[model samples]
Structures are given as C-alpha cells and as structure tokens.
Target: MTSKANRPCVQKLRCLLSVAVGILCAQSLAFRNVDSAAFDSFANLTAKGLDSIAQFGPAGSIALAACLGALFYRIYPNFKRVGKRNQLISVILSFFLALSIVVPRLMKLPNVSFNSFPNYVGGVPKWHKPIFWMVASIQLLTIGFTLAVIICWLMRKAADLVECRNTGEVSTAIPPTNLSIWERGVRFFDGKPMHMTVATLAMVLCWLPMLVIQGPAIIGVDSMVQLVQFRTGHVWDPMTMAELPGYVGQDHHPFFDTYLYGLFDELGLWLGQEVLGFRILIVLQSIVAALAIVVSLIWIKKRTNLPDSCICACWCLAAILPAFPMYMSIVLKDSTWVSIFLLWMVAFFEVIYRCNNNHAIGWRLVLCLVVLGLFSGLTKKLGIYVTTVSLLLAIIVIRKQFAAFLISMLVPAALVIGFVPMVVLPALDIAPGGPQETISVPIQQLSKVAILHQDELSKSDRQAIDRVLDIDHLKPYWQADSADYAKHYGYRLNASSSDRKNFILTWIRLFFRYPKDYIAAVPYLINPFVYGETYYYSGPVRCGWWEAGGSRILTEYPECGLSYTQGKIAIPLTNALNKTPPFSFIGSEALYTVWLPMLALGLTISIRRYRNLCYLIPTVVSWCSLFLLPAHQVRYTLSFLFVFALTIALPFAEVLTKERNISN
Candidate 1:
C-alpha cells in the first residue's frame, strides 16, 4: 500500500527534477557567452523577454498564467494515462501552475514607466521580477513534463520487451508513446461529425471578423500588384513586360495563377463595388477552406475509426490555430495553398493507402491528387516539393502500385514544370520567372558580415563581393536577419559563369572565418518555417497594420486594405503571445509545416512504421530548401503543420483497425 501511494509522488518528483535540470541548464547557458554570439543573443533575448514582462504590471502575469494553465490542461492527461497515482501528482502540479498565475499578482513590483524617457529602450527591469518567477515556474513544469514523458515511454517499451521475451511470444502491446500525447498539441476540440459541422459553420461565421479584422482580401504587396495587373489586363499583356520579378517575385510568385484567379475581382466588380465583390470572394474562400477541413476530418473518422471524442479534440485546434480559418479569408496564394495541400493529404491516404488491390484506386482519384499537387505547387513554391514527397511516400507505402504512383507524380510535375512554364506561359504572353532566389542566403550572410565582421573583412573580400554585386551598393544595404537590402547589390539576374565562381569562392572563404554569422543568418531567415518560439499572436492576422498604397489598385482604392487598431481583436492577442511565454508558444513555432514528417519519425522510432517514413523525405527536401526561399512568412509553415497533424492520426487509425480484427 505504501509503495502504491508513493509511486505517484515518485513520478511527480521525477517530473520536478526534469524541470529543474532543464532550467538550470537554460540559466547556465543563458548568461554564458559561448563562442556562438547568435546563441548567446537568443538566450539574452529570451531572458530579457521575461524581464520585460515583469517590468509592466499584471498583464504579463495574466498571460503567463493563462499559458501555463493551458499547458497543464494539455499535458495533465499524459500523467493520467499512466495511472491514478500519476493523476493525483499531476493535479498537484496543476495546483502549482495555478499558483504561478496568482503569485505574480501578489508579488508586487513598481511598473517601469516608459513615459519619462524620450525613447522607450527596452531592458530588464531591476525591481522584483514577478513575471520572471511566473515564467520560470511554468518552464520548470514544461521541462519536467517533457522528461517524465520520455522516461515513462522508455519504461513502458522496456516492460513490453521483457514480457514478450519471457513469454517467448510476439508482443501484442503497441508500446505507448508521447505520440498520443503529442497529438493533443494539434487537437483543439471535441470533434465529431456534428462538431466538425459546427466548426465549419463557425469558420464561415468568422468571415466578418476576418474581413473586419484582416481587412482587404488582398494579402501582400505582391498580391495586390497581381490583382491590379489582372484587372488592367497587364497580366495578359505582352511577354515584353520587362520587370518579371517586379510584378511578382522576379519571375516567381506564379503570375499565371494570379492572372487566372482574377475572376474573383471581376466578379466583385460585377456584383457591385470591387470591395463588396472581393468581400464575397473572401467569404467564399473561407467557406471552401472550412469545407476542406470539415471533409478531411470526417474522412479521417470514417477511414481510421478514430473515436469521435478524439476527433472532436482535434477539431478545436483546426478552428483556432492561426494557420487555418484566419488565413482562409486572407487574399494570398497561401489560402489556396493550405486548402489544396490538406486535400492532397486526405487523397493520398484514402485513395492510395487505404484502398488496396481489391479496390484499386481509380484513375480519377490519382488524377485529382496530381492536379491538387500541381495547383498547390503553383500557389506556393514549397508545395511542389511537398507534393512530390507525398507522391514518393505513396509509392513507398503502396509498393505494388509503384508504376501508377510514378505516373501520378510525373504527369502533374510535367504539366506544371514543362507545359505550364514552357508552352502555356508563352501562349498567354507571360514571362517566365527567374530561377529560385538562390542568392538570398548569400546576401543574408553578407548582410550579417557587413555588420558583425565589417572591419574583419579584407580588400579581397570586398572585391569578391563587387564581382557578384557592386560593393558600394551593398554598403548601405546591410540587414543582419534578411537579405532584402543586400540582394539589391547582387547581379544575380544576369551573372556570368566567372562571376558565379568568384562569388562562390568568396562566400566559402567568408564562411570559414565567420561561421557563427552564417549560422545566425540562416536560422534567422528559416526559423519561421521550422521551429521558432518567438512571441507573436496565435492568429493568422499578425501585424494587422496593413493599408492600401504599395500597388496601383491599392493606391486608387484605399479602402480595399485593412489597418487594425491597437488592442483590437488579433493584434492584442498577438502582442500577448509574442511577448509572453507559453502564449508565445502558439507563435511561428506552432506552424512548423514539416510536422507531418516529424509525426512520421516519432511513430517510426519504436514501431518500425516504415510506411510512415515516406512522408519525411519530401518535407525534408522542402524544409532544406527554405534556406534559399525568399522570405520566412507565417504562411510558409501552413500545410505542413495541418497535414502533419492528419498524418499523426493516421497510424493510430491503422493500428486500431488491426486490433479490431484481432478481437473479432
């Protein structure tokens, strides 16, 4: 009896120790100037962030408390899954987490007034740092939960292994994993057919909030430009349009797609005013996005036999996460990109994986998936890579249908790459975009070097830069985190072979010397597409300070854009998330599109789910190429995150079906 009583306490203690260790390590390194200045800066930024939270009043405290409470509710189940003793201990941790919220308010400190200073330069406040305590307490709890999960998972696997060996029999137990727990991070609601229906309706209902909040369906400067060209028929104008990169991305950005999609604007004009028409178009887009999500969830339910309760849990996340309904109404290729990608994931499983030889997937199904992949790739650069990966994974999982799989992939790719760009673009009088913005990364490296190691640079280094781009032009354009400024200095559009060779040599030499700068510059650009734990809102309408001006149409129709006031819907929420811990958890890091690959990896670790490995390779291809992509916008990680969530649920569906057969 004593042993039983103590077990929960022991587990809880283990979690506590994990939390402590993780924190101590974080603190130890947080202050240390380890050779990597970037790592040190990241740590300091993290530390200073906490201090800034405390410098204010209870706002930071409340956000911290809310985030911790959210996490506790999220992870509390893992403990319960182990046993009742673990449940009791988890409750205690929950209590402490709750105290973290209350304690900050009680631990009073003077609010650092920013009004006194002419400029509000941020620094860690010296007064009692209540927010720090609130933050650290939650950090400890999170770390503890993570370690306990790993240890518990290992122990379960070990026990299963031993039992199988002793019995001299094959192990029937599907070793429990954090996969089940990890699944919750993506699960947002109690989803069922009804729940999904409600979710879809709710998503549609938010059309107004999305419209009012996001304002102007046209998402970016480039998107607005496309809308104008399409409206003015400049899109279908002669291929002689010299600024291929200017109208879209220097020959990228899929101008053909935007040209074709111009009917939405035409419909808007036909309906009445362009604004009203665009509004209708946006609402329709939201409806389509909602339908895709709803249908996908329902299909998962039918194919996998996953419990309605679990599906319901997954539903809420689809609704609330910034990548979904919010982006749905935003007028950008990403809205379509996410929708197509989600559909592709469903089709890959339902048509390719689930239906066996007895019900061989029809040509129509294969055709639909191929079409989706092509369109998705057209909308966003990464989609092509992701689509190719899905096709590869499909071939691997459905080895018997390798020929069919290869055809599906090749057909769509050929059409998109060969026919569309080569044959169709010429017919439509559209100029083909230039190659991938490969020089972006180099410019990023150069930008960082100009700032951090400018004095360290030799004349030879200067000459090398001049060969690729004018060195004098680059001097004024040094941004550490982005190449936007530096890229202007490069002559990538028409570089000679000799120019490329010298640029490569100079770049390599600089890399050998300033390795840290290169590392810093790369992650700074790519983190938004991968693992970024910065403070931002959990909604898609981040930085809602948009207004009409960049493009000709936007300049004429000023009301066609959105400019959210401070403290209004998304900005306030985003401010809290971007500034506070746990809340910040929902920021860019939450949207890692490579999550499907990550999910596949986790499931394959203990169980040799080689079928799952198919998802990983192509996404990795997409992720690696992000370093060379143009920008690190929130939309970059969209489809990967949502689709990966679907992939995570898939294996369980497969396992459950097998289990049912066995029981029968």
Candidate 2:
C-alpha cells in the first residue's frame, strides 16, 4: 500500500513538471510571434525615424517583469520564508543583472525604426518585440534563481541560529492560551447566523450604489452610452490632433482613459457590440472592486479576531462612505487605483503582523512592494506618490523588511522616469518640439497679460489680484512649461532651466506658506461631493460661495463659512486638548457644533487610548492634510471622510466591547 501511494505521488510530480515545461515553451512561442509582428510594424510607428524599443531597450520589460514577479511571489508560501537581509541583496543583484542585459541590447539596436508597425497595421497595433521577450524571460529567471538561493541560505542560517541559541536542549512547546479574548471571540462567533447577517448587511449598505450604477452599465444602459460620447468627444477633443473634424480626442496620458475605454472597445470588438461594451467594463470593474473589499474585510476579521460587527462596520464604511461610490461610478483611474491600494494595505498589514518571522516578512514585503509599485506606475502620478509613501512607511515600521521595500520602490521610479517621461510625454507630443510649445505660448502670454493688467487696476482691486497672482510667493509652473512666463513675457522669472523643477519648488513653498487654503479644497476634488452642479462649485449651497450666480455669497452670507473654517476649528480643538493646559473655553465653544463633534471625539479617543492603532493615523492625517492644504474643494475631502468614518467607529466598537464585558 505504501509503495502504491509513493508511485502515485511520483507520477503526479512528473505530470506537474510536464505542465510547467509546456507553459514555458508556449509562452516563448507567443513572445516570438508578438516580437516579430512588432518589428515588422516598427517603420510605421516611429516619428523620429528611430526605434521605440531600440531607444529604451529591454530595460523596461525586465524591470516590469522583475517587479511583477516580486509582487506575485509574496502570495506564494515558499518565498514568504526568506530573511529580509538576504531578500534585499537578492533584489539588488537581480535589478543590476536586468540592467546589464538591457543596456547591451539597447546599444545593439540604437538606430532601429519604431513607426513602421502602425503604418503597416493601419490601426493601433500591439508592439511586442523579441528584445522585450528576452528581457522579461531573463528577469523572471534571475529573480526566481536569486530568490531560491536567498531562501536556501536563510533557511540554513536560521537552523544554525536556532541551534546556537538553544544548544543541546530538547524542549517541548507549551500549549496556547485557551482563555485569550481573541480565541473566545472566534469561538463565540463561529458558525453564528448573526455574524453572517452583520457582514451581509454591511456589504449591502456599502456596495448597493456601486451595484446600481455598475449593473446598468454592464447591461447596456443608455447612461453609459451618453457618458462615453461626452467623454470621447467633449472631454478629450482628439479631432485637432488628427487634423480632422469630430474624430473624438485621446488624452496622451491615457492610462486611465484607455483602461476605462479599452475594456468596452475590446468587448465590443469581440461581441460586435460597441455602445454597451465600455459601460459593461466599468460596471464589471466596480463589482470586482466591491467584491475585493468584502473579501479583504473577511480576511481581516479572520486574522485579527476582531468582532464580526466591527469588521462588518469597517467594510460597510469603506464601501458606502461616499468617496468610493462617487469615484467608482465614473470612468476615472481613482476607483481602480483605490481598490488596488486597499488590497495592498490589507496584504501589507497581513505580511507584517501574521508572518512567521523575519524571513517571511522580507519575502512578503518584496512581493507587496512589487504589486503596489506596478499599480502606482501604471495608474496615475498620485499612485506613484502614494506607493512611495506607503513603502517608506512600511520600511520604517517593519525595519526588518527594508530591503524588500527598497526593491519595490524601484518599480515606480522606473515607471516615472522611463515610461512617463520617455513614452507618455513623447506620445502626447508634449516634448520640447511638440504641442506643449503651443500650450506654453498661451500660458506665458496669459501670465504677462495678468501682470500688465495688475498695474492698471485700482488699489483695492490690485491688492486682491496681487493676493491671487503672488507669483513671487506662488510656485512657478514646473512640468513641461517652465519657460512659460519668460517665453510669453520676454523675461525669465526664475534661473532654473527646467520648467517642471521651478514649478515644483515654487508650489512646495506656496503650499507651506498658506496650508489652510490647500486643505479647504480637499472636498472639491470629487465632483459629486461638491454641493452643486457646476464643475468649480463647492461647499454648502446655502451661500453659493462657489456658484456661478452667487458671487456675493461670501460677503452676504459670511455665517455660511467655508469647509476650511470648520477644519481650522478642529485643529485648535485637537491641539488644545493635547497640550499641558487646554485652550480657553470661549474659542472652543465658537467652533463647537454637532457635526464637528465627531472630529473632537476622534482626536480625543485616538490620543487617549488608541495610539497603537497606527492605521488610523494615515487616514486622519490625510483628512486633515487635505483640509489644511491647498485648495479645500469639496471633492478633495471625499476620501478623507471615508477614512474619517472608520477612525470614529473604532472607538465606538471598543466602547461597545467594554460595555458588554462589564454587563456580563
């Protein structure tokens, strides 16, 4: 019987190996076909008589694959056991190895043409080349080999360390505590109907709007049709670039747009249905995002042994908490990015807290960084910023996993430098010799005109205009249009040659100088969150502060203050309580209100007893940061509210638990 069992296991292993080899071969063939096709079309695709892949070489492919592989590896059980130091060394070596391969290939293909493919294909062609195939393959192989070596080394080292710590000792393990609160909580709620009910209710409440909007789009609704038409034609205005009338425009930085529309286009092409296809894609993504949230929440509940009700509340709050619904309904990048971000956060927390030891943490960290980095790179500029910040925070908190964090950060850095600047900027024709020149002319002329007009205005009007135009105090435009002021005005405002650099430095200073103005505009970042129909309109509608016809609302209805005012009140209240002696009662009462009460409660509870709840700090700070930073628009604070809701609820959950214990 034992021999029969052993034979079956051996057969199964052989079969698995056969499948793996088949997959590898198939992938190689597919890559070759794609690469040949790309090379054939290169002449039609190049604008500067240069090869796209040849110029950039295989670096991106290798970098992208390595990053992606690291991310995927985190989900694997085996890699989760590698030590942090070993993992870091492996990643660094692998990265350099990828670069070594790519640099030589790029040198070899320096003069190749890139545009022929598009010309031959007669439409947007997928450009897959052999260089990329080779690079990606090498990346995969290197990372896999490096990781295996690191794991083996770490395992051996761990064994030796264990022996050294407990030499000649034979000890039995102690049993786990039976009376632990978490254990009891799990036992009490196991297979209970109430747990399921709470979870179901929370999910429904949080995700119902997403379902309503997404379902219609998925099923070929009229609303989606209108939205696509408006977005393609009005929003983008691609006709001018094509030198044709009404061709529907494309955003050169079309990662978000393409992602949103490509799904529809693909579905339509496949099914012979164009109008309903894009909408269905959007709806499907929303559904998937909602489901992912539920799944993550379930995982959290299982892992943390937190009350089912608490988990349910967090899920519901995350889902319906306003920010998600507004963004997820639109064909924007935020929904997808936010969904991925939340997933990453969950994965990150799990890897840090639940991993077996330093080795597991290291591997998991590497994986998390890769996923987060890729999403950030492929999504939006903000995605990169968020990813960097999150990775930094992870490294700081999980000091043992710093190597993984650094390796992960390289993914985003590569995207920003290689993809965004080289690929995206060139495609958009926003390069020095591109359409940016035209845009810069108007911007520079406008700035000069505004300044010239400033001299002719009345003293009071001049003061107000000066306050708005404070160019000396304001950060200069950075990005592609740094010479904008000088180009139009015939004089340089700053010594910097790079326009983007000047703008960033100036913007940074301006933001620091008037932090309150920046914070007030947070709510206005989301369109629906603003209490008006107009794009620029924000805040409460009672005063029409942001309304087109309510220009005098600020003066006439001063009592209906800006949202920033409320945030300002919150800062003092929170700050005073934290100090040795609290601030005067008069100022506190002035800012006190029922809605603002939660802010105080949240701060108080966080400071007093929940200081260890570090997760809450980011949300709180993000909320406060948006409120206190530049441009306090209603939509800007939408994400803040979603986070704020969870922060407030945690304290209440604790209170409920305490009450229950006391009563029992």
Candidate 3:
C-alpha cells in the first residue's frame, strides 16, 4: 500500500469490489419488495433510471446509478476514438432510431396527451407531472446514447472492412473441396451474364399471377374518374363548372393520363370487349415497367463496380416486392410515372458518369435525356421539380459539361413547364387546377389552429381565414390525417390570388402567435410514415359495381368492368404475405420513404463518399417534396423504392464480394 504501483492496483480492486456489492444489493431489492404488475407498468411508462426506483427501492436506485456510471466510463473511450464524421452520423442515426421506437408507443399510450399546446411550445404537457417528463426524458436520452455507442461500433467495423477491401487485405471465405448441394446451387449462376431479356422475363413472370387473379385491371377512385372523363369529355364531377365557371375537362389530374386511358377504353370498345382494353393496358404497363426495372439494374451494374450476385438479388427484390406487382395491376399514373422516371434517372446518371470519366458525350444520349425529360416532366407535377433540381445540381458539380447538361435537361423541362401550362391546357380547353391543391399543408395548419383556439382569433385573422375557409364549419369535415376533405370540400374555391396571399400572411402571423398548433400539425398528418402507424400495402380490386364515394360511374358503365375472380386464393395469400415479418418490412412505406433513405445517406456520409451521394439525389429530393405536397400517401412514395434500389444495395454488394480490390 505504501508503494505507488501497489496503490494503483489497490484502487482498481476497490472499484471492482464496490461494483459487485452494488449489483448484489440491486438484486436483493428487486427480489424482495417489488410488485411485478405495478413495476412492469411503471417500467413501460418511463426509463430504467426511474424503473430502478420502482423495481429496486430507493437504496438500490443509488446502486444502479453508480453501476450505469461505471458502464459509461468503459464506453466513452471507444466513442471518442472514432473520426468526427462517424461520430456525427452515429448521433443522427441513433436519434432517428430512438424516435422510431418511442414514437409509436407514446402515440398509442392511453390517457397521455402528446399534442397539447404546452407540449408543442416547449412547456409542460397536459399531464403536468414533472416526474413523468423526467422519467420519459431520461429514457429517451439513455436509449439514444446507447444506440450511438452501438452504431459507432458498427460503423467502425464497416469502415475497417471497406479499408481492407480497398487495400486487398480482406479475402472471401473459401468453400471446401467437397462443396455441399446448397453451395453448389449458389455457385451455379455465380458468373453468368444477367441479360435484360432474362431479367425482364423474371420480373414480368412475378407479376403475371396477380394479373391473372385480378385481370382487366384493378381500378382506383382516380382511375375511375379519368375513365369517366374520357367517355364524357369531362371530369366525373359536374362541380368543375361550379368551381371554374365554364370548364368541361379540367387539367386537375394530368390530361395526358386522361387521354391515354381514353384511348385504351376506345380500343377495348372497338375490339368488341371493353374489359379487353383494360387487360391489354395493364399487361403492357407491366411489361414496360419490368423492362425499365431491368434496364436500370443493367445500367447500375455497368456504371458501378458491384458484384453480379448483388445485382441479381436486387432484381429479385424488385420482382418479388408486393408493391410493384400490386401497383402494376392497379390503374394509377404513379406506376407509369415511376417507369419513365426510372429511365430518366438512368440516362441522367450515365451523363454524370461519362462527365466524371472524361469520356466523350454522345448526341444519342443527350437526345434520349431530352425525350425522357419531356415525358418525366409531363408525368406528374413533382417530376418537374425533381428533374429540374437534379439537373441544376449536376451542372454545379460538372461545370465542364454545363451546356450539354443544361440543354439536355433544361430545354425539355423548360419547354414542358412553359408550354404545357400556358399553351397545351388552354388549347385543349382544360383549365388548370385550383390553388387549393398546393396549399394542403398550410390549410391543415390553419385547421388545427382554428379548431383549438377559435376564441383567441383576432377579427382580421378571421376575415383572412373566411376568404379561403369557414372556420365554424371546418370541424365537421376536418380529418387529422389528411387535408383532402378540408382543402377541397370545406374550402372557398372562389378565393382569388390576393385572398390567398392575405391568408398566407395571416397564417405566418398566427404561427408566431400559436406556434404549438403549427408544429403539431405536421406529425399529426404524417404519423403513418414517421410515427409507425400501420397502413395498407395494397387495396383490394375495385372493378365491377364498386363505388367511388358513392359515385355511379361503375354502376352506370357495367360493360367496362372486371371483378376479383380468385378471392379465395388471392385474399388469404395477400394477408399472409403482408403479415409476415421480413416481407412486411420490405413492403413498408416507411422503409422506402423514410428509414432506408436516412440510413443509406447516413452511411455514405459517414464513409465520406460524397460523390456517391449523387445517386440518392432523385430519391432525397422526391422525399423532401412530400413536406410541401398534399399528403405522404404510400403511392406517392412508390418511386422512392425503385429509385433507391441500386444506391442502397451498393454497400452489401461491395462488402460481400470475392473480389478484393473494389473501389469505394
């Protein structure tokens, strides 16, 4: 004890003895006095710090805290050793993961109010119990920090693997001289060329079973409206005249989609079987979409240094995911938009690849971009913004190819944006949609404020709101999850530009006055995607005699209909597939639109692969666009899944490859 070296060893022994004693005390307290049922409930409500108090009594709480401190003492050093980028990514990913876990539980907890004014404005919640908040905060911070440590370790290992691969230090596992049957099966297609024909055939075959079950097309409400518009030369609603005063066909939905559906309907009518037209259309869309998926995969294989097995796995996923086949059978513009957008993304990425490698740019490629750009921009409203913004970013990065990129993207996009809205819609006598569509989020925010704080509204604020909405009447039509009823059914469509402007200014002013309401509105609407609320992966076939909000279109047009012919097989199989664990995860919209994107971007950034991030541009921009749009419905995020397939699957391909000298 007198010697300095001996004192250090003695101190270490003392610390170990104290930890052992505390752990023993904690165990004794837990077994002696705790009521299992009450303790379990309390544990569910709060973090373990508070749980220790309930489960182990006051004395053991102190011991548990000491034990936790020591545990952190051991963990801190490893966290400090990682690079700054890795540390940052670990923190961000941990926060997201913790929220993903905690949010659903908190949302579903009975008698707990999460959306009170005080909660949104950084004050005590309606629960008003300091102990509850203290416990909740402790749990959240503890879970987050714990996840950060785990993520840091994982990233470090991944980085090491990547470094080893880059330096040719890591080697693939060697199979035994006597390979097993399973290993032999895996090795059979190891080096075979993944041609487009074979790949497309595989994907199309995956879709054919669903088509056979719900043949002639599975129609949605929007599809029915478009079909009716074709037959009558007007949108299904006679209300268009009420809104716009003299419009027959409105460009409210994409007119191009309407025309296409009309032509297909006409084709079926002329062929003497109306259902035949829809069947042909569904089949053609499936085949074309399958081809586009394969094309994108082939392009990715050529451009990136990913393994063939990885590419094959991705093709398998695209072919088998329930959403792809389900949407292929359904008549929605989103399916067509995604297919064109896939081609457009490939063409755009190839241009960037060529520019980066200093290869000569070709005219055929530029023309392809122009043509695809035209179709992509015209496909959906969001496509215009995605293509235009991606092109601008490309120009900024590859300034050497500025004019070519600009003309390739900008010319087609510019012409579509300017001419279509200004020239084409008017020429076709189709009035552009009302401003109500774009103001979904703002109107939703207004609904929350109006419903909760009507007594506090100033007179001028009331007038501004009254121009676009009747606050007193909104409550009956208000839905927390969507602004559809509120924006369209409850809105004053006659409101002019100046009226909208005044309302927008009033909205901004009131946001400062009632910040809590504005803040709470977003999560309320998007809880399905962000807060783990359950949603349908696909809907049942709406064919013969089904109604859209009690519309008579299906009842009236009996000849132009088909039914779900194999419900006995299709229904049970669909339910089982959706409820299955891994399949369920793959089909989830959150995986595509939120979690996967966040995870992929985080990993890439952590590894400092900045250039590789360009592949995520289309997906990230499309996701961001949801904030300003009407809703974050599953169909809206369908493109995210296909767009991200190549980029997100890259790491798996690289890490598992037998080849050692892969580039990062």
lDDT string, candidate 1, 419-515, tens digits: 8777776666666654315566776676567566767788887766656665455667555445655665544456666766777778877888888
TM-scores, all candidates, are 0.67, 0.42, 0.74
* Better model by TM-score: candidate 1 vs candidate 3: 3
Summing lDDT over every window of 10 consecutive residues in candidate 3, give the lowest-scoring window: 114-123
Residue 267: error of model 3 in Å?
1.7
Q: Return model 1's CA RMSD, one decimal.
A: 9.9
Better of 1 and 2 by TM-score: 1
- Assess the local accuracy of residue 270 in candidate 3 as a C-alpha lDDT between 0 and 100: 91
**1 or 2: which has the higher lDDT?**
1
Give the TM-score (vs. native) of candidate 1.
Answer: 0.67
TM-score, candidate 2, is: 0.42
List the global CA lDDT of all models.
0.52, 0.39, 0.63
Count of clashing pairs, candidate 3: 0
Give the alpha carbon lDDT tens digit for every residue of 171-287 in model 3: 356567665453433342332445456667778999787777655466766666667656754443422224343555666677788788778878888998766777788888888
State the local distance difference test value for candidate 3.
0.63
All-Cα superposition RMSD per candidate = 9.9, 27.8, 8.7
Q: Candidate 3, 514: how far from true, in Å?
A: 2.1
